[model samples]
Target chain A: MENSAIIQINQLIKRFPMGKGEFTALKGINLDFGTGEFAGLIGPSGSGKTTLLNIIGSLDMPTEGEAVVLGKPISKLSSKESAKLRKESLGFIFQSYNLLQVHTVFENVEFPLLLLDYTTAERKKMVMDALEWVGLTDKVKSKPPQLSGGECQRVAIARAMVKKPSLVLADEPTANLDAANSHNILQTMLNLNRELKTTFIFATHDEKVIGYLKRKIFLKDGLVDHEEWINQ
Target chain B: MKIAFKLAFRNLIGAGLRTWLNVIVLSFSFVVIIWMKGILVGWDHQAKNDMEQWEIGKGQFWHNQYDPYDGFTITDSHAPIPNEFKPEIEKGEMVPMLFAQGTIYPQGRMQPAMIKGIPANQTLLKIPTHKLDSVTDVIPAIIGEVMARSSHLEKGSRVVLRWRDSKGTFDAAEIEIVDIFSTTVPTIDVAQVWINLETMQEKLLLPEQATLFSFANAEENRPAVGDFRLKTKKELTAEIDAMIKTKSKGQSVFYFILLLLAMLAIFDTQILSIFRRQKEIGTYVALGYTRQQVVTLFTVEGAMHAVLAAALAAVYGIPFFIWQSKVGFTIPMDTSEFGMAIAPTMYPIYSVGLILSTTLIVLLTTSVVSYWPARRIAKMNPTEALRGKIQ
Candidate 1:
């Protein structure tokens, strides 16, 4: 993972203001995520998995040390540079199936391509292909509110995969679904990762998602407790 | 920016009732503001036209001592009609007018009146001076409806008219009301009577003398007449212009309140929408929009309300404005008392500039109003916003 790394983090630390005092969320973290790796940060509530994922997605900056993502130092990236990195290369899926409720499944999926300046026809094809990959082609016209939990997650997945981004950061992607829906969403993400060679990094402690990941980094008390490689 | 507009348009449409509710209120403002301004424009246009035909007649030459505001000057404002204007008056292109302070006793009720004299043969003014040509034993006079109503004199009614001559010799005579004319110009009407210029000159004992000369050839340049000042049509209508300007200023406060309400509706909607759509804003940022871009998107979305409102205004306002133009807006009250050239019913003039300026004003104002709240998004933290947290 280190040699083929698409993300390299060394001695990373993050802090939050806790009413005049500070709470350190990550303590001297060192990690590397190679291309095409289906990995996750496993932790309990408040274990800082989401914070770590957020930093890697360039949504936040590390308070100390270096986080180089796709060769751009996340700690030093300007707001615009970070936005450009996210727009061109990164995709995000959220726990609540953070699909734009008013948008149709197709529109939700096409959102990323709209930012990439794809032609309308190209966007249409790309969105359709991504929906097909998620087995949500039949639900293209349905809005997120009209879909089942599993269907909404798949739409979220399609949105994440539409641009074929180099990285997909999903935060507790299955936290709101039932067991069957959760497994279905994981299987879809797993298949997408394998076929597109896109790296998947999720922040979750769910067993269903943990079972599908080939690599897992366990966090306890804002520290990496251990890491294990499964099905390698 | 184009993509922002597109997205904003989609979002506004997607919001359904919320968007339309705001748009409808704004559209109402659009119609009303345009309509009110149009009425003022129409009134100005009509007043100028009426003054041109009934009173000013291209322009007037006023006696240097003649101030319409001062009654003391009326006794001395009279000057003998200049020799140079006599040819034009003979050509029926100019009319000499004389004014005198007089008293009329109709049905035993005394009323102070203005005695205005215009040549019976002149075609420059719309007054019924020709009716004065066939004067019988008594002098024939034309009075406006307001004067007739106030003086209680009707056509065929005989009244006593008394006035002082230039020599300060007071004289009295019997006069018959020949006609009671209806006109929009109060300057030519209210408590005033029109009689033959020759008859007025004879009664005032000022032969070949007049207070002013009204010329029909508005374009012809005139040489300086002895002690008389040339008043152009613009200067002549200055009173009406000033009145309309004052009315417009008074109405501006109403317009501001109207715009403020409409803008407040839009501004409130934008601020509320920005707060309610925190997750959506976060989603937008996550999907590659910088916070500033999201702000642009919200601002565009809000400003598009004006565009939508304009279209909505056109949908209903066009027919209303057209109907208003056809039927004219009627003042329920008599305009004769206003002492200005105001008609009972006034048509509105809607110019291209007015419509464009109004739309642009509403748009720019709405954009500014929308932008004020949208600036908050630039400072938002996408992570908290993603969770739909307020702070």
Candidate 2:
């Protein structure tokens, strides 16, 4: 990966309200991700990994310090500006597969493109192409309820990648999948990362997900403990 | 807005039975409110038309002393027909009616009745007064169905009529019922009888004198004459208008209740949807929807139920309303018993304005109810919502 940073963080702290007190989920966290980097925030539950991912994704704001994605300070962005940023340049994958249950696989994949101003033909082509990347082209007509856990995850991945966003934030993406399904999903994502040169940041403690990461940042009690790099 | 609509439509359709239940309830409100309002409009139109055709004509010129509700006023309400109306009366554009109170004994049963004398050949009113000229040995009289039923008098039935003339001399005679007419106007039908004008004048010893003159039209600029009150059609029908206005207010209460029930269903569904679909809401936000946009999506989803309800109402209500306009709705009891100008069967008339306005009202009400609960979405934390956590 190039040395250009797409995401920058400096002394970021996040506190959440907890009846009569505040719980600090992240404390003085410093991190940076570059273009096309396959990175994971590796930590156990309550380590604030998901909280850090949420901040980077512009879904949450920092209590102190700064987090900037695509050169825009997330803490200072208005709700509308933050939404526009996410719409134009970000994608998300969740552990529970957050695929719209009422929609067909193809419609779910086409949702992000619909938010943009793509024409009907362009949207159709993009959705079909994204479905093919996850090998779910044949199951495009199926609903989420009809799909297996792994298939649902594949659909979610296709939906996230349909717009070809600059960054993808995945929070324990493979937690609900079996071993084989986890590996298959990870391989597909890794291939997309290489082919599309898209930056991917993951918050996960799962070994299957950690195995696919090129760089791992270990977090403990809302602080980074250490970091590791793998040579593929 | 377009994307929101498309998503809302998909969400509503995908919601399956829950969506349909709310829609069905809302549709019932649409049909029933329109139907009830239509009936009142129909009744108002019919009552005015019947009064104009049968009793009031276009207007009336009554003697200044005439008080229709007071029976004692009949003694002094008579005045010689004005000479100014002579031309219209000769042209058959006006009819003079003379009124007197009398008692009738039909099969030894005593009943009070109003004696009305209308021109035998006049065509201005639809009273069938020409039947009065066919009498031979007895005076010819026409009574309304209600008067006939109550007095046990029918066409061709003879009854003893007792009255006093202008000379204060009591008179008794036999009268033959030549016709029994049916009319929706209670004032024209209940406890009233019609006879030849000349016969009534001659019997009452008051020639060339009448209580009221029914005209084909109310002349706006006509000079006021002494000892007469010129009542326009509107003025003559003011009581009916006041009655209908009062009735409409009562009907509005029913409309409010119907709307409340439908809105409650929509409100309850919206609240439940926000609670159950928190993750979907978060997914929308994560997919780049602002929390405001998420709230709008839910509101639109709730309001779309009204659109669906309108369609469903048309499916069933169109046929039912059309059939009702044709066959009409029958009252279980006698309309005359109500002492109003009501027909035994009433045909409903629905205007496009009424339908469109009713639809707009229902649509707006449902939108408000939906928006009330959907505002909760704007306060939800996207991070917690993404985990499907209750906020």
Candidate 3:
């Protein structure tokens, strides 16, 4: 089955101005990820994978062409509108675990919902539910500093899923973890994707990370070098 | 919003040493500004008080200050006291007062001093109310403690005083010291003598109404009695305050410039902070925070530091003001030109306006002083913010 497209990019370009010249980061690219698909964007250093992720995440404006996610043409949204969309529809996970270090595991998971002005009781329920999904309900009171690598990644996963967004964008989420920790975190994220049918998109250079995904797109020097599907 | 505050609080603790250092610097700046504010206002108050009491409204009032001749006639014709100015002299508030240089001869010792004669009814000179009631004889005098001590003369002891009379001529008299008094202000308490208005009129040998005139106290609550056109202490103070205002014309601009300088420093610190923790800011952005949300976090962080510092200062400063209010601060007599007779016993009058205005200034200074860097952090592209960290 070709899972229905959730994101589409076409003729995308990004340029940077040096003192007297311009450097092109993304010359042109075309790609698509289907609904409920676990996908990885892989590239070498300076290959512009992170740049592509930023554009797709609505964290940046594209210099040219179209990058659309979840039926929203991100480039067309005003800054405030774009921010609202991200808050309501997207989740993010980062390599550093990005759990607010001062908060307990429960608070870290509940942090995004706080911005939504949910009542305390609702927040508790949602956060606990997310923690359970990550097998971290027992560590709800623990701060990030107290957690091991695998547990920290689990907390990050809990935070992302707590918002219950349609899509999750992760940038090098397992880059800081050991091999076993990376494998465990990937399995946990894939398990959540299966249960919730949420789309998961990753920008990474790790072969181990790429192997877990059902779809893969590889970029070389800002151009799409290959796009493939596995076990479909 | 709660997450913003929580994150801000966390950022402060996460960089404990730097946060504390900012607090210390901020507190020091607060103290310096407040201390300067107190001293300037204190000095102006002291100056005005002395002026009203000593009969020098704006600057020194001259009983013929410009006239080279001694004891010149102040008639309605020759050195005319303006007819319009008469009611001021007639009223007790601006009563005619005279000054003359004299030699006081106690036995064989003679010392040169200024003898001032003021109306016994006028309380603006700070003659104690109880003592005013006790002054029964017109020819008796209030001699400075320094003069009395030097002369070895007690109250009721008679001494000879010689001076040039109102007509540019010489005159002499023998009078008893009715009161020997001292003021913390050294200028007035040393080398001086005070006599009743009538006594100095007699000694200076002037006609019944000859003396220089100035308003007693402009800050007083008294209504205007008549055409008393004497310069009020308030008018004099207003002039002086206006002059200082002109001197400090661009103070707000200077404050802004200082705030800018402070902002630059804050930016350097915050940028260094952000640089040192590049991965941290990147992590926050990646974790679903908008640029505005990030800015709000840092700005609130800056405000918290400012408030914390001000609160600490207030904790110490309020009690200091209270102690100062009850006991008063005594500036030494020798420190000012006004002399011991005019020394100020300053009691700090607390005003909520002062505290509130000062706190706002400090908070604004800190926030404005710290905003540039916060914007820098907020405006950063996520790629640049996460540049070195994602690999």
Candidate 4:
């Protein structure tokens, strides 16, 4: 494996129990993700993009073969060890902008660092900086219910990047946002990627997300068909 | 743990009216349980104190044949006063008494009574025995207010009293009521009459004799008097302790019911919270929480309701107790008919142990109720939860 490879998969297979049998989500597949790479697994629904992303993010494990994230095998890590990996080295953004509904915007953004056990002062500064990246520093006290869709997505972005983790995995992050809000959210993520040199992997079927990806891997029915690198 | 508490605290506070509703129910339980337990404790204390003061002194020695509950024993319950108690009796540290079955004719109505005899100047008891020294042509006798009312007699009212002597001869005399004392202890009152010890001995033709003796100082050494059996203060008040224990057992059912209601509210709230907050649980897992950590967070959130409830209880309970102290609780019905020493209006005493134990019980019950539903989080699939899917 290359020193720069933060995630590596070896003939990975994933299947979910379906009635008396099973349905394969990701057929035998292999992939690699290097440090500081801006990448996306692009395909339509049921094309295995999300299953692949979940494996890389350590939220799920391959049934056959290996998925090594940050040098820890996804299938072998204990529950505490996996949690530690997510806490210290990985972050996630969901499509629905799943901010803790009752918490203020600041508290939502501060959630990652809270798990990482940063000093209060350090956590406050980092959270502010992350919110500033998304231009949401002024809405610190507003809860999710009080915010617009665009603002809530920005808060989710701030939460994902607050700890400056080595990798961030976003699954259909723009699915619920309007085109304008989606573009703004993508721009903010792009700026964070360039500034901090953090690796970002997105599983998306939206063309708008595809336009921002530096590298796109297209999946066709649980198999990686091909990948294309764009010239920046 | 500290961070979990902070988050739990914020979450509970953020829940708004839903949070306060559960808290109010739990706090109400706190106040009511404490109040009920306090009443029983106060009753126990007051009942024992009254008995010690007006009825039994430090202790008593009953003649071998004496049985307070048996009327047949009263005829043979008398013996010459024990020699060992003579010095103490003279020193005012002890007093002797005797009682025999008798009948009274008051207002031309026949009534059975217990004719009790005590030293006119005895200081060992709260009974007004000195009133027997009153100068009157008729024998001066004292009765309790209950007896006075039932007999329709007043101070200076003369009534016919008849009783059998030690030799089995019957005699009758007119007795004047000199005093009508009031007391909480009914054992020494109700259908009873008191007169001078010497006067009773002369009338019975049996000098230097008494039924039982009560000592003022419990620490004084008592010698064995073959004719009498010694009873300690503890032995005499053991019944009160046993009675209080029985009352407490009955009160425990109320405690259980109160706790059950409060816990049901909390348990319902927690189930609803866990069901509705599936996305939040997913978000927590994605943000570096283990399934176990999420479980702990939810449990902490649930347990904190008790803490808040306790705070709310103190806000109202302290003042309520203080005000109640000023005006004691009035028994809704007459306590006299209970055949025990219960004041019509009794003051409740709250102790540190009672408050602390009650707080602990509520806290623990709430936590257990909270944790039961939170365990569901541990079995949830984080991948599905993030999408807010039903688990």
* Best of the candidates, DockQ: 2
Candidate 3 lDDT over residue span B242-348, tens digit each: 64465345554554554455445555676676566555566556555677777777777777777767876777766776676677667665443443223456544
Residue B138 Cα positional deviation in candidate 4, in Å, after optimal superposition: 1.4
Judge candidate 1 against the unseen true structure and give its global Cα lDDT, from 0 to 1.
Answer: 0.91
What are the runs in model 1 whose C-alpha is more than 4 Å off? none
lDDT of each: 0.91, 0.91, 0.69, 0.89
Q: Model 4, A119-168: lDDT tens per residue?
A: 99998999899899999989999999999998998999889899899999
**Two-chain DockQ for each candidate model:** 0.77, 0.85, 0.44, 0.82
Question: Which structure is stronger by lDDT: 3 or 4?
Answer: 4
* lDDT of predicted model 2: 0.91
Which residue pairs collide in model 2, if any?
A: none
Candidates 2 and 4: which is better by lDDT? Answer: 2
User: Of 1 and 4, which scores higher on TM-score?
Assistant: 1
Q: Model 1, B1-391: lDDT tens per residue?
A: 9889878887888889989999999999999999999999999999999999888889989999999999999999988888888899999888889999999988788889999988888888888778888757899889999888888788899999989998999899998988889999988888798889888999898998999988888874665598678989999999889999999999999999999998888989988888889999999988899999999999999999999999999999999999999999999998887988999999999999999999999999999999999999999989988999875
Question: Would you list the rank order by TM-score, best first?
Answer: 1, 2, 4, 3
State how far residue B297 of model 2 sits from its true place (Å).
1.0
**Candidate 2 CAPRI-style tier:** high
lDDT of 2 by residue, A1-232 (tens): 3559999999999999999999999999999889999999999999999999999999999999999999999999999999999999999999999988888898899999889999999999999999999998899899999999999999999999999999999999999999999999999999999999999999999998998999999999999999998888
| 10 residues in a row with least lDDT, candidate 2 chain B | B217-226
Best by TM-score: 1
Interface RMSD of each: 0.8, 0.5, 2.6, 0.9
